[model samples]
Target chain A: MKKLINYTPSTATRLFLGLLPFALLLLVYMGASEARLAENPNDRLLPSLTQMGDAIERLAMEPSKRTGELTFWQDTQSSLIRLLSGVAIAALFGLVLGLLTGALPVLNAWLAPLLTVISLIPPLAVLPILFIAIGLGEASKITLITIGIAPFIARDIQRSTQQIPTEQLVKAQTLGASTLQILMRVLLPQIMPRLIDAVRLSLGAGWLFLIAAEAISSTDGLGYRIFLVRRYMSMDIILPYVMWITLLAFLFDYLLGLLNRRLHPWSEGTNA
Target chain B: MSEPLIQATNVGKTYGQDVILERVNVDVHEGEFITLVGASGCGKSTFLKMILGTEQSSTGSLLLNGKPMPNEPGPDRGIVFQQYSVFPHMTVLDNVVAARGFQKASLTGLLFGRQKRQARDDAAAILEQVGLGHALKRYPHELSGGMKQRLAIAQAVICKPKILLLDEPFGALDPGIRADMHALILDLWKTHKLTIFMVTHDLKEGFYLGTRLWVFDKLRHDPQAPNAYGASITYDLPVSQEGRDTLDEITRQLGASRPTIPYKETA
Candidate 1:
């Protein structure tokens, strides 16, 4: 073979390398399911892929006998709406609060300690409080996710804002920017990309809070469907649902990454 | 001679009880290139900050154009720091145009077509002058050290400030690049007729570029009473062709009399 300056795997090799572990996992799961079904054909603990596919088709394509709605789509729509609403609110609130706390010493003195305290309290522990105070409806669940994650997002943005070099702020002032101008033009644009990254980082916990809230009192969410089917040992639906949630989270993460790369090319190495 | 462009009278800075600089007095004339040379922690940077109006004098007043300078920074004074002088997120072209946009409009007005094209044209012309015309779209991090400093100067000078303050603008560059920067600064100074104040530890650089040099050092020292006093302008020289010899002689005499004590511990 001709000598190469650097060893880089081809695209096909890279694809195989990325998929190998997942393929192995599926193989092991199928093998176990096949052996278990052979011994006990009525086994529900580990459903075969065929069984899961049938369940997914029923939930997704067929209308529910009682409500005349595609149950899977309904659950997905409700769950996504709640999750996105909570995340959007948290991100907006975090940016404003973080900017205030980071830029102004007086505000930092007043709000930073309180925000620290809020961030420390276990979000799951406060689910009951939210349900009680806000009523056991969509409001409570969305509030739960917001409460669980907003403080963290806020804290991340505050620290990022604080870490902006003093020289940049002074330089902005020298360039004829007023305090408000500095905050809006100089600080806001810089903080936004980091804020998106912070949201990306906090998303896993956000999903946890969302699912927990949905499992407790939700009427028609993905988490509600999962918990509702658990009593009947419906592994076919549950397993696929779990995978679907993971796939959704992955998709959202990928989209956000693309958005960050597109909108804020300046943040590549520094943030990524 | 024209009236003094900047005048510092007994300016002093202190952080609570500890003094950083004291009894600093100077009269900077129009179109003069002045350089401040001192050891680290000798309050050279602090003195420059006072002139920039970012920091206030705890004791005396700093006057610019016969009026006491404001406590805050304004467009009348432009400064290029050693690092992070360019806004990292902005492109080179955007960075230069930002000064024009900000000076004329608020953030909302800037978003609309309220002179943006004019600003871009002006900025492009300035960038061409600074030799960064080809790199207008590049970010600050994409530029070499020399290019970044040149962009910083372009951004500062575009504002047409009466005074341009540089805090070790070439301190981070290699010798070859530093020489290029020195030439660029001198060229800009002559073209703009700007009053410039620069702080640097390189004695040769201070002696070379400046029309006048101010050397800050601790004149009074007692290890037991360290916080009792701090640095001051111990030697001031007017760097004329013949005055260069006098400056060298004074530097030799001062070095012989004053032993070097690390200012870090005292500071």
Candidate 2:
């Protein structure tokens, strides 16, 4: 059970401060738009706005119409597949690199320069080169996202693993635990909170990279729809699409936050 | 002759240029309760580490039951550190069962099976011994300081180690809790016949619990940088056979300055 918060405004405060300014702004914008519509009665902007409004209305009327109802399901499906594959590959590589660098100072020193150079190469900068190598396909996009996010994950996990308490390790050793047992039981459990945090953070990074990847080269998908609207200067369509994407991003963040809270209850008391 | 359970001969340690201990000899008789009393930096904790095989001795050798000490720690010796070293993520039951996993009592000796009933039973019995049976399901964070120390003790002794090394085990508790802990430990020692080696700054505690007291006085060697030269045994009193007699002698020694006589009979 959670505590409730009171946010009601006093009657005097509400009467003095609320509603008037926002009401006025809406009216002014509608009046200006009406005046513009009178001059250009058959403008394409009006039709596009109507189309976007119609889409929203249809979505509200029948939510299932927006569910699994994209013409580019194949492309979306393939993109999803590539994204999951890339995550798996990147996670494996990142874990290996993290373990090597974390356990051995010499390995860390050797990889430091390389990792720095790799991190500095922004995702956008490499899209063009990746297009040349893999030709504007799933490979190029997935590779770009993987390379962009893996370093962040690797660095986070490495630090988490290294921060395991020395006393705990000594205690485990004195308990007759073998190296494998110590790693599996002591080291892994201690690092789990940080590892889960890193994974959630990386998921956000993955979503950002997904949008950027789609915008760069794709005939369909959410990012392609936004890019298509941008070319025609259809601000109305663009705004609604941006709102939809923001809602999706918000949902992802919320779900991940709920999971983090459930898994690490100790963190919530301090953080809240 | 009954063999010494723990024989540390000429045990010494050094941290770079500074020597913490040198030529320190200790023989822990089987089932004998001993306390090593010293000031800070007397290397008492370091000596315990050496016995536990967590830290290497610079010189000399330590043997357990006439067997050469292994390169790594084993279940033959259990240790309770001054700091509550129990695993915070695990329940009290899990922490105790962790060390017991390698023992023969494991289910078909398989690594992962339903929790071994016998091990749980054993852990429960030991927890009962430590008066922490009701805390079986509680995490380390849920326990108080004294309870945490008791859990640590339970965890260390669950495996039935031949020798139990405690380094200031109750030093962190409050006065009331500390006294309670002292009595609890003494009771456990008597019932289990555990060869206990404890390090403490509390002279009264050392006198109350230890069968024999080994005092490390720093002021005896160098008054200015007293801790530089490793601590020497300033007073070695036997308290096992003569508990009251020993207490009176200690009181007399405390009152008298440089008393020549070793033992004084109580009227």
Candidate 3:
């Protein structure tokens, strides 16, 4: 038999190993919930699996009292819409700014310092100002996420573009590529994976901004629901909402990873 | 010789206080392979860059085809640096085809129908000439040093630039690979009728390849204004008849011509 230290596990073994910690956590939670309920059946802090399940079923299956629409699904849809819109806008702007700054010296000199200053400002600190300036509509929330993440994405892609060897630029020029052609053909294809990776990295910050905006001003969103139930001490709903947000984030990350692999296998292992 | 293809008259380059090349004068005619050799900070590569229009001479004019070299890089002047000459992200075939695609078509045309196909075929044929026919799908990093240099050469000349510049293109290859690259380069030069300018550190490589050899060195030194000067073409020897007798004489001249003053660090 191979020694455990040196032996590599097969995929099936790895999958089982991955599940072991979650299994342990479930057992621990079940035991603690049972003990807590025995002591006081009215406890809300540590809701049991049954209570959480009932909460989820109500949110998932039942309609809201005020509107005929399901609250949970409505929240998911609104949050996702805000997130995707913000991210799309940020990605496009970042790509253009990064490309321009990276390719041209005059632009780099003028804009790079400004971008640095902007990126240095903590995005959350500007949330109040954004709300004041843009108002409490969908524009404010989406703008918040865009402002929170776009500078970071731009800075990352700019560095990647600048790191491209000078020889490639000269060669492209020698090949009759004009400035615009070089950007679209040489720099664009090369920096695209870097952009996607940058977006993936900024997703956490994106979510933070999205949630903060929703919590402060929005009517319908995952963040609005989570914060709304907090006043009522609805731990059942809050915990499930938090878990669902994590699952959604994980799903988005997984999909982006899949796209990166499928579209640019050449860039594997080099970028995030 | 018919009117010189390129003329560099009193060309000099300098930073604020530091000098790189000064008062360099040379004329290159058609069908001449010129090789530049010098010490590390002697501005051989800088001269090549100036001709390619990536770098500007602070002082004089460099004329190509009897016109001042353009301020920007264009399809007429091609160059292959030591490495990183080919885009790492592109496959060998795509790297070759990209030259034609950019040259012949606008962005939209290259993306869609007949232009793209034609570019691909042209690129494939050029790759075949460079002996990279089988490795069309391979990325730059996947190739050996020799293969990468070959790919770079193919990419540079695919547009059929009037002049080709090489900067120590085989410096990183092993000796065996370097010899293969030398043969390949010579073959390409003869077939394409390219007016070539190459820079190499190896004296023998410089001698073996060039029809004209340029040796850059600081001939004069000023103790008070040390940084106010630059290197120049201290020796220009025509080696169109590159034989053992000619190389032996040039070797003696090179040995005798080594700078007596301690060279300044200007790179």
DockQ leader: 1
- Model 1 reaches an interface RMSD of 2.9
lDDT against true structure, model 3: 0.86
Models 1 onward score TM values of: 0.92, 0.76, 0.90
Considering only chain B, report the TM-score of model 2. Answer: 0.81
The CAPRI-style docking tier of model 2 reads incorrect
Candidate 3 regions exceeding 4 Å error are: A1-28, A269-272, B105-112, B221-229, B240-267
In candidate 2, how many clashes are counted?
0
* RMSD (Å) of each candidate, 1 decimal: 3.9, 7.4, 4.1
Candidate 2 DockQ vs. native:
0.22
Q: Report the lDDT tens digits of candidate 3 across residue range A9-48.
A: 8999999999999999999988998899899999988899
What is the C-alpha lDDT profile of model 1 across A13-96, one tens digit per residue?
999999999999999999999999999999999999999999999999999999999999999999999999999999999999
Assign candidate 1 its CAPRI class: acceptable
* Predicted complexes: DockQ each: 0.48, 0.22, 0.42
Lowest-sum lDDT 10-residue window in model 1 chain B? B258-267
Model 1 agreement with the true structure over B168-211: per-residue lDDT tens digits: 88888888888888888999999999999999867777888998
lDDT of residue B223 for candidate 3: 74
lDDT of 3 by residue, B1-267 (tens): 689898999999998889999998998888789888876778898999898888899998888888888988899888898987887777898888887777855762154478778878888988888889999999877788788889989988889998999988888878777778888889999999999999887777888787888888777867788667799997788866656786566556555655442222112
